[model samples]
Target chain A: MAETTRASDPGTGTATPDAHTAPLSEFDRDTAVRRRARGEFETVIADGWSVFGAVNGGYLKAMVGRAVAETLPHPHPATVTAHYLTAPRPGPAVIRVETVREGRTLSTATASLTQTDPDGTEVERLRVLATHTDLTAGPDEVRTTAEMPDIPAYEDCVGMDLAPPEFLRDAPIVHRLAGRLDPDCVGWAVGVPSGRAGTRGWFAFADGRPVDPLALLMVGDALPPSVFDLGLSGWVPTIELTTHVRALPAPGPLRVALTTRNLAGGLLEEDGEVWDSAGRLVAQSRQLARAPRG
Target chain B: MAETTRASDPGTGTATPDAHTAPLSEFDRDTAVRRRARGEFETVIADGWSVFGAVNGGYLKAMVGRAVAETLPHPHPATVTAHYLTAPRPGPAVIRVETVREGRTLSTATASLTQTDPDGTEVERLRVLATHTDLTAGPDEVRTTAEMPDIPAYEDCVGMDLAPPEFLRDAPIVHRLAGRLDPDCVGWAVGVPSGRAGTRGWFAFADGRPVDPLALLMVGDALPPSVFDLGLSGWVPTIELTTHVRALPAPGPLRVALTTRNLAGGLLEEDGEVWDSAGRLVAQSRQLARAPRG
Candidate 1:
């Protein structure tokens, strides 16, 4: 529930709250609550049902990263394999974490999310595998074929007036974290901040919204055509999505580079990396999606 | 490879020399491996690929499982998610287990398998997420939708007219683990005796050749049509496979029950569960596949 205070206390139409704010920044609000708890783990069940509306992809991705941060060991980073069970509607849900085993160097926990229904069945389950390390030499021969595209910056590219539907007006989480998108700005995400080894990167929405990792993962499969120089209108729907998050960035700009290794008649596979401003590879995503018709 | 003794040699065709010397009963093989490794942890890669086969799913699954097991603390059960990056061929591979973090009750480990290639471009990366556990309580409404199906015994199911494939006959590793399958067998599996908590059932080819889990995963999805009375002519190819191994079952006489949910507009989704004769749930698998016209 949200407070009913807006600029339009009376009748000025111009002072009215934005329609998209009906469920404005619930995750941000929730985090504000959790921050007060000294960063201990918390759970809020998703109780209502509605389309995610205009939340940007990157913001959703950040949500997932936040989820991982909430459950993983503090200070030590984690690599998580997340599978989207279904699109969640804005509501409340409870997340439970059970520490499986704890060792000197490594630990494991299982997080299960059960959606509250009158019938009471678990709708989704997430298993995260995290490793703790002080520091070590990483993998060698790290090569990626994704070349950064020449897109405009956030400031110069705004106000091109390419808007979508009402429900989707500025709701995507990606745009919020990366920064306001200028029309000239291509949907490129860089890795996370500096001093981070392994992978870290920045990601934002083409249309601005808050950045959430879950959204990026939800739409990471949508990059084959864009990565392969094909139009988004031509690709098939994604059947499965699998993302590997090595580490989180220090919070900054995001650049995404996509490359296609195999694309046949109807089936296609693409790999993408999310980079932050500091050029650390924050996250990597791979998916098997259907290639839409040209 | 196996030593070829003459059929006329006493106790040759019936069982192997070890079996002749210490006559392994059906239960002996079932419980032998399980008893040997309980409470204590074994360094699977310490022996370094001594017992393995090229391209078999069972060998791959077990090898991967053992890799994860080595990283776990003594006597902790492990549940692993092995993602197949590429098809493994015959050869030597190394399984490295690193402790992530150890705690009082639970612990975790990161296990990876790297196959050395002659070309050496990209070594096939098999990553396993493993964990160990202690006491846990779960008296909730425990129910599984994976219903058992009616099938003939493993011996009755094998046709006398159909000679088993040469690969099934010749592989030493396969011959050692052949009792794992029965005619009334629920599904194709390859597994060695765990000699610990329970049996570990897996998928294997008839030719004593170890089958890949992906291939067995395909069967898990395909059989639902037959099990659910869809009356389809041929097996359907899987479009998506999602599997979760809740617990390990012993290596022999595993039962699998597949239920088809729908076959509409060329797409199908099947739900399945594998159980032992003791009526315990060992594994759960679900698949989304395209039903081709038989």
Candidate 2:
């Protein structure tokens, strides 16, 4: 089967020549930040991460997470919320971080990403607030009423590259990451939407870099808008997104489910859940976005 | 019929002398903000709004919303996310608002609430970011895959005052707002818990005030922690909460459903949806909070 072959192909599954030997995966390199001052860092929004004409909201959030994690005493982000002010293009940007408060168990901080235009004007693209804590220090007790979506086996799912959606064909980020869309949820990909507002899929870095707490921020908003399944095809710009990292993901492809429960007043809310290879819920997210234009 | 009686008693259902004659409802009077200057406002954290020892998270968010709405070009908060830093006692506080951006369709602002101590120390309580717009100007179209929970009728549910739990015996907020708990989901109130992490309830001001967009912020976090259903009964301090107000609710009691799906690493997330009296979805929210200490 073409789907099974694409899932295992070394070129697609592991983009790096040697996953174990690579110093930094493409994701880490693209989202890398350099400390310039006490609370300021410099980074670049690399090319090929755009969904339509703007950088992915989750990718921008990852940059904020990296900067925040470096400044706070606690390393892992427990909860992060980012508001997209302007769609940032691929270019040099600066991140300004501020420590809001430090508590016994958690520390809170706020950060903003801005890009300078040739006119010397700075444009604020994203503003974020996050609370950080050491995940390892948490209690071992685990209790959950959440369950992962029932997706087909890794090899049975349809690869993104197999029959690329019209809008996703030229998007480089799709190639940088290996993803599979559950056949049941991708009816819209073939011009016959299931008339539902949900999507289930699998995700992993093509280079095989292990998923971490920081990467979970990216995974939260990485899926296509669930509205597409309802035959609403257009760019659904996110107004705000909030992510809660529950645990460190185990090494393997992650399972993801996205659902839109309400669409009203030209806006919709998308709720997502991500589970690790071990079938443990790793993160949950909710985002508000504009419905596709009429 | 104790539950039914409590739900309609004049003292509990409508505490005010006259719903129409009263100049201001208790909620508005308590949440009222006085303009101090441009982008600044003064308010008091009224005594009866605390959940335990701290003020309700939603109440605090409503204060921020009021302040932000006053400074921005838009009048209603479309999306608001607040990070709780320190719990402020019932006292005078200051709200500082700043316009982050103003666009044709939306305007974004950030605000902070700080309380002063007797020692002249100013403590930061909450930080918020919000996007505001004229909700009435939005398109009238509506579509939803979400549905209200399968809750009993207003009079069939058990009133909070019918059999007040031990922890809620002294909570003034419970009395200020009349609430009914879904019988099947409130087993934790007694010796036996339902062993689930969900709660459905009906909420309205004890003073017979109409529901609005700003008040929806309070409704989002007004319910008790859903974890109580799982026998995890203690104070769950919210770290952060994000509420998206979809529409101005029709006048009447609001229907609320809260669910906690995953609890891990001493942290849990609660997702809530609120529907107005007209049975239209008005708001959606997600909050991250500490799992009650073992």
Candidate 3:
């Protein structure tokens, strides 16, 4: 099964090596891979998580997510909002956490990710505000309400086409985007504007690691801006993004729905939902980004 | 106009005192109403903003928004996320900011709002991660794309009925809710479940203060959880909410569109778009809140 999903690495332009051959346990092992001492959490971003030049925001989020989650009694991160301060290069980073109110039902905490400068000043990297809670025990109001949209199976969606930017093309992950009748990224990928908005797709690591909560964040925003389909172009940068982890996804290619409801006042808002293959909604994210210029 | 709008104070239930007597500029006056010393941004959350017990989240947000925006070269609070740590009784609060990265075009900063107890130990109150940018100079891709759903004019919409909760009712704000042939939070008011899920309204302060960007934040989340209409009942506490200030809202009763896209595993996500009376998309917000339970 992995063989069929196997393909050359577009970002590296290399015969996609079985670099994904690492065990699936690495998802948990790598994301929580941190050490704490003297009021700070520190971690080395292991290999294979870069999108283009910087580390994937989702993976970075997982690092802080775990660090902060550990500070609270709740085992599940109900809400986590990470503010990218300075995107640090994949490397040794420091996370300092402040516990706000450690309630029995819910715990709210904040973490700051930083790296030391050569001059020894702690360079701040990211600020994360998270609420951790025991999902099953939360106020006892559980229901699966929004039915998953009837999206075609992973095999039905198109494999990533004309790669996003040169940077995102080389990621060490695999993606299966939804097939769209409209043109994709023509303004940037091609020379003309496709003049539509929205991009949907499924994603999994090349090595077949099932997506955990952290990876879902990465995969959720990792898609090309839906605006690209609209024929608008440029780097559509994420100004602020908030993700709600609905449930730890069940294994397999994660199916996702992505769209921009409005492109106004020089900004576009992307609304994305991630559904596990089991058809359960796993996570939902909304990001505010600048619309790419024509 | 003030006499006409200044009819009742729902949340306070006071004989609508001269309290609503202050000009709407007081919202701005009370929010940015700050003092900075020793690298701390401080302000008093004046009276009149709380819905029931604590200050409204949107009002709290504007306080931080103004303080942080004042610290940045860009005066606009482009993106701001506030995680309620522990609700502080309206009083003096201190905001300590950490400059994330002050780019020429955009500046990212994080602030921790704290209030000192009688013991003198500062209690961490709220965490706000904000991006400040010059709204007018923002990428310049200005284009109004999404059309506001045509609805009755402000006067045509019924004045708020079936007040949201005992807490939101009797507040100084006056709400002109869009009358729904479908059931509303009236169930909560009448001790019955409405068995539907949706709420839309027009709102402005009782003193005739037009909604500003800061006030818009409050009004955006002010409506009863569309969930109440769904028959689920309990406090739908906001876990985390992110709002984009697409453009400074024009003065008038802001039209807000609110709905939860999905309610899975005890969590529901509310997507809200706030359009000015002029029908321009001024802001959009998505929040993760607990599903209301009976």
lDDT ranking, high to low: 2, 3, 1
Q: Taking the tens digit of each residue's C-alpha lDDT, what string does model 2 give over A1-294?
A: 133433453323333345467567678889999999999999999886776676788888998899999999998999898889988989899999999999888999989999998899999998898999999999988898787899997778887767557766557677666778898998887778887899899888766666789989988778778998998887899998888899988778899999998888999999889998788999898898999983
Assign candidate 2 its CAPRI class.
medium
TM-score of 1: 0.41
The lDDT, on a scale of 0 to 1, for candidate 3 is 0.65
For all predictions, the C-alpha RMSD in Å is 18.7, 3.9, 6.1
Recovery fraction of native interface contacts for candidate 3: 0.59
Give the alpha carbon lDDT tens digit for every residue of A180-203 in model 3.
Answer: 222333343555644546566666
Candidate 2: tens digits of C-alpha lDDT, residues B19-106: 4785676788888899989888999998888766778888888877888878999888898989899878998999999888998889
Off by over 4 Å in 1: A1-27, A30-68, A74-76, A103-105, A118-122, A125-161, A165-167, A170-202, A205-242, A245-251, A259-270, A288-294, B2-80, B83-294
Every candidate's TM-score, chain A alone: 0.54, 0.92, 0.77
Candidate 3 chain A, run of 10 with poorest lDDT = A8-17
Ordered by TM-score, highest first, the candidates read 2, 3, 1
Candidate 1, residue B21: lDDT: 68
RMSD in angstroms, candidate 2?
3.9
Worst 10 residues of 3 chain B by lDDT: B8-17
Regions more than 4 Å wrong, model 3:
A1-32, A116-122, A139-145, A161-194, B1-26, B29-32, B52-54, B115-122, B143-145, B161-196
Q: Scoring each candidate complex against the real one, what DockQ results?
A: 0.03, 0.78, 0.46
Best of the two (1, 3) by lDDT: 3
